[model samples]
Target: MTYLEKWFDFNRRQKEIESLLEETIAQQSEQSLTLKEFYLLYYLDLAQEKSLRQIDLPDKLHLSPSAVSRMVARLEAKKLWST
Candidate 1:
């Protein structure tokens, strides 16, 4: 094969390995998240973490605060969070 062709193959392989490594890490990350946690983290930006308030969550989710509280409590009980 030509030198150019060999170089192309090496570059392509490096890209493939990089892509595979990225994909594996992404999946590991995704596996660590949950649907409810997505909502919590969404609210938690880079600014701060707040106690999952009872009022706003219902309005935000279109579900009752009682329901949201129960779900949040379950998550807390499961050791999903600290504060």
Candidate 2:
């Protein structure tokens, strides 16, 4: 009920959800995906025309612009190789 208690509860639930998501992704995907990668796809899927600018991804993914660029490059490589 207290602020500290509420914060702790929120944090605990977030961790639980992340764990469940990670487990499910591992079980379902042919190629292993990190949590951030999964989140990137999820965000794109929800975006207009299923597209988003790299500049917007850093705030959404809590990563730097360079990190987003690297991640996008890696994902693109994986897509090319998978096909």
TM-score of each candidate structure, all chains considered together:
0.44, 0.81
The TM-score between candidate 2 and the true structure equals 0.81
Q: List pairs with backbone clashes in candidate 2.
A: none
Model 2 worst lDDT window (10 residues): 74-83
Model 1, span 26-68: residue lDDT tens: 5866344444445554565433455555566677655677777
Which prediction has the highest lDDT against the true structure? Answer: 2
Which pairs of residues collide in candidate 1? Answer: none
lDDT of 2 by residue, 1-83 (tens): 99999999999999999999999999999978888998888888898976688789999999999998888888888892110
Could you report the Cα RMSD, in angstroms, for every candidate shown?
11.8, 2.9
> Residue 67 of candidate 1: its Cα lDDT?
77
Q: Give per-candidate clash totals.
A: 0, 0
Candidate 2 ranges beyond 4 A from true positions: 80-83
